[model samples]
Target: MKKLLYIDANVNRATSRTERLAQALLDRLRANEDVEVTTLVLEDEGLAPLNSARLARRTAGTAAGDFSDPVFAYAKQFAAVDEVVIAAPYWDFSFPALLKNYLELLCAQGVTFNYSDEGVPTGLVRATRAWYVTTAGGYCGDYDYGWAQVDALCRLYFGIPDVRRLSAEGLDIVTNDVDEIMADALRAIENEPL
Candidate 1:
């Protein structure tokens, strides 16, 4: 079965615009393929914080080999997925802290990516496409910050060329046409021109 992992990094625990968009896109994608959706709700899940020991093990080429540790298993699960979707609201010009921590777990040397001959990093995840989903309560003047980081990870580091983003800005502040803005965001997601 084709695996699609959706990582929810919002800590609201109620509802989030980015989460809704991700769900809508996932429903659409499910219509065409036999796929399994995996959700990593970072707020509820008890994920180990990537500390110096973990980082040292990862950099020292021992994290992947530490089969007894469940972190390795989680990293392996991410590496084996066919597709990935990250839903994180724009917070202080970037994604949430939980999402950052999840990414720290994914930076396994011999797993998701590796070093090339010239000491350049190369990704191993073979997803045909991936997405970065977010929403902003204000104008996207500072939006490039988060998208740029995600792009670097998904494209340059992870080798996923088809990484796309769906965003809706000024939803909370722009009350004149809030529904219209949301509808347009949904339409944009449906007609993703990536």
Candidate 2:
């Protein structure tokens, strides 16, 4: 079965426009293939940030060739997925801290990636594609730091060759119709390649 990981970082939960758009995208993707979707709601996951102690444990575990800890579970799942979808609302030029924390745990050196013989970093993830979906109250334009960061990480670290982005911007603009904006985003999602 094709495994698709859905990482939800929408703090608003059910009321989030980004989440709605992401669901539409996922629905389209599912229709194109038989996929087993695993949803990780960051808000409900209670994930802790990587502190010094956690880092040290991870390092020690790697050096000892032991990955049986629960801390490495996320990285293991990430490496085995076939695709990834991250949905978040644009806040303060980025996504929430919860998503960052999740990424930190999943970016284990020996789990998600490793150094090659030439000293260059090589990706060990199995995912072939990833999509970052976000909603911005205002025009993101060239200042979309959240999407940019996710794109870079997917390509550089996760070995995901195809990375795409879906966004709905200007939802908070007084002159713009929010429903119309969302409808357009949904249409775009439906038309996106699976």
Candidate 3:
């Protein structure tokens, strides 16, 4: 079965619109009938932050020899997945730092990617596509730094060209048109052909 990795970074379970929308997107993707979904809520799983010890191990050439702990296991899990979906609310002009940390772990050299002559990167990730789902409080306008930047990183740095984004804005600002904001996000996910 094709593996689909869903990474949820929102900690607020009670009123997280981004999480809700992500779930909706996952449902739509799962309807394809050919994919198996594996959801990881970051808040619940408590991924370990990349510390000096981990860095030392990586630098000392221990990362390649170790697949015994959850940290290394997560990297393997990420590498084995067929697709990846990242869902996180926009915070301080970007995603949660924990998601970034998780990404740091998953984007390890010699695992997720390799470098050839002239230092050109070649990705080893089996996933042909990645969907980034997010929502922001204020309209980021032309300077949308949330998913747009993340998508680009996934494409350029990670070599995943099939990255797509679904977003909604002004959710934090209570307005009469709140329903429309949510409806648009759902439609965007529903309309995705992938």
Best by lDDT: 2
- Tell me the TM-score of each prediction against the true structure: 0.89, 0.96, 0.89
Candidate order (lDDT): 2, 1, 3
Runs with alpha carbons beyond 4 Å of true place in candidate 2: none
Q: Whole-model Cα lDDT per candidate?
A: 0.79, 0.90, 0.78
Q: Is candidate 2 or candidate 3 better by TM-score?
A: 2
Task: List the candidate 1 regions with Cα displacement exceeding 4 Å.
Answer: 62-68
> Mind giving the per-residue lDDT tens digits that candidate 2 earns over 1-194?
89999999998787999999989988898899999999999899899998888888899888887888778989999999999999999998888888999988988888988878887778899999999999999988888888888888889877789999999999999999999999999998877766
Of the two candidates 2 and 3, the one with more favorable lDDT, higher being better, is 2
| lDDT, candidate 3, at 75 | 67
User: Residues 11-65, candidate 3, lDDT per residue (tens digit)?
Assistant: 6867998888999988888887678999898888777778998866664543365
Give one digit per residue, the lDDT tens place, for model 1 in 1-194.
Answer: 89999888876747677878888888878876888999988888777678887667666565345534555666677778889988899888887777777777876777777788898989887676888888888877855577788778878777787888888888889455778888999998777653
Query: Model 1: what TM-score?
Result: 0.89
Estimate the TM-score for candidate 2: 0.96
Best by TM-score: 2
Q: On a 0 to 100 scale, what is the lDDT of residue 5 in model 3?
A: 91
Worst window of 10 by summed lDDT in candidate 1 = 62-71
Candidate 3 residue pairs in backbone clash? none
